[model samples]
Target: MDTAISPELATKAERDDLLTLGVEEEYLLVDAVEPRAAEAVDAVFAEVPGELRDGVQHEYYRTQIEVASPPQLELDELAAALLRLRSGVAAAAERAGVRLVAVGTAPATGQNARIVDNERYHRMRQRFGDLSPGQGMCGTHVHVSIPDPETGVRVLNHLRPWLPVLQAATANSPLFGGRDTGYASWRSMMWERWPTVGPTPYLRSHEHYLTLIGDLEASGAMLDAGMLYWYARLSATYPTVEIRMGDVMPTADDAVLLAALARALVGTLLHEVRAGIEAPDVEHPLLMAAHWRAAHDGLEGLNIDMATREPRPAWRLLRQLFDYVRPELERHGDLATVTALMGRLHEHGTGAARQRAMLASGASVGDVVDELARATRGEPGNPPID
Candidate 1:
């Protein structure tokens, strides 16, 4: 017997029929003059209008704020939303006498005066100890809708080896605690302290994924599905696979490029799964090491090649990644934009390299922040110097 779709199911099914995209970006609220982390997030939040209130949010730390975009179809639409959100949040923070800077970690490493006054956040601080308050990092998260949990799991499985490639392209945080951490993404170092924050091994089926989540809940490391903080996971709140790698990019262009790559990767992997392609048999340790290399070296030196599991220059890996997903990009009409962004990233270096270059040339931490601030406002900050 053939089954017919219910009206409700049809309505819900329509949403996942196409690949919709969403973005979540986090920013650090800092003292306008001294560039120290400031506790003015509350005031800044108050300035957001109620109509624009749904997307603007306070994060785990008092000095942090986050904004999310609604589902979008075109890359330009998402880009516009991000720009508006950045400017909106920037205006509010400015009114509060603080500036909104888009780096992964706080420039000053001093302890936060207070965490977000939420029960869950408080519990996280208690559970994680010093790791919670010590972190002031932010990230750019992209959510791409999948037809179902089964497909979502498959997408995550195939995405494992490539997450580090995305991380390297978006590595912007090279400084933390008023000093060079000597790694491109110091925030990632702080983030991995949580027991559940890195990439996960393959889940052969959706049932296996649910079973694993149940086990994690039984172990009490996580309160719920929301706490399943893999680098990429099926979003509990949306019918989407959220790719949560990469630092929060300083400019809207970089953020949109990340989103496009994420969507293309998910779409390509989903098609491969439907075509009966097997997911890569990658070991979990290898994935973790790949992530570590990208975090430590960014894109300037070497990175782990997902195809061969061998060391290669970061740029070569990035090029290989683009080739892997070229078909999907062409399908979505994003190849040109993605290619242009790739060229720009390679030419200018990853965000971490750009930040280091400024600092290396006698630019103070304040100068670095100023340049990042300029980029956040859609102005071309300092270009990559030779």
Candidate 2:
């Protein structure tokens, strides 16, 4: 097999066949001088340039903003769109006299952890009560085009076991309230406080998926389909499977790496579904274990491998994912880019590790947030201590 992926290889970028993908990243706004979350989304969103305004929008919280890339077939095009969204939003936030930081949760909490003043969010706050207080979390959601709901459910099944590895790779919330939270991605811990936010169950078909959504709604576990916050799900509004696995990463490069992997995973599984390969039927309990382990250790420690129900180094699991999706990645002209990004991930550690490194070097929480602001804008930060 000519499996090599290089500049000379025939890539999907050079062909017409490719899967379309888009990325949605939520960011925290912090006072440029203070360590706490800043309620500046209104100002920042107003200042976003007209060209990029369509992609930039407010999230559930006034302290956060979200940017979504338009669907694109080529990895290069997707990367360019992400760069424009991140840089443009960063510039807008700065002009609003706030800093844009991409860590999954704010390093310090303030009285300003409030939701956007809208009717929908107001109802959410009333319904969820204290569960809504921790709603300040941010995440990176990747949407890959799918043909139909039936195949999208099958894709979700294949995606479940690998979701932990994705979470581990992008864990970025290590600090909260001016202290190390012990968990690598505190955002994951915060998010799971909601009734519907957890591992996606293996589905029998598209009907099964919809049935569960209706059940959750009737039971008050969720108010609507949009609140079915599984780690992966069929998008309610788009013809795409949304992978809501990772914490918001620190840089556009990190986000693009994840988006490429997600697209390749969906493509590989779509082929497998057509070939009659059974999606791995991992149990829900084990899936939950894997997610918790990943959030606790990020990429620097053991992950529960569903294949054996035993722990393996997270890096090894990530490599196994690359091997499984190598063909699809090469087909999409992303193998080389994925290869290079993995090297960087290995060298720099995850966003969580990098933030922890700054603290180990005696930087204050305010200083850590400053470093995150630089990284969020795609500026390089100091190397990890480990």
Query: What stretches of model 2 exceed 4 Å from their correct place?
Result: 1-15
Question: What is the clash count for each candidate, in the order shown?
Answer: 0, 0
Name the runs in model 1 displaced over 4 angstroms.
Answer: 1-17
Model 1's alpha-carbon lDDT is 0.83
Number of the top-ranking candidate, with lDDT as the measure: 2
Error (Å) of candidate 2 at residue 144 is 0.7
| lDDT at position 144, candidate 1 | 89
lDDT of 1 by residue, 6-44 (tens): 355446436544477889999988888876888888999
Model 1 pairs whose backbones collide: none
Q: Write the per-residue lDDT of candidate 2 for residues 215-276, one digit (tens) a residue.
A: 99999888789899999999887778999978999888898899999999899999999999
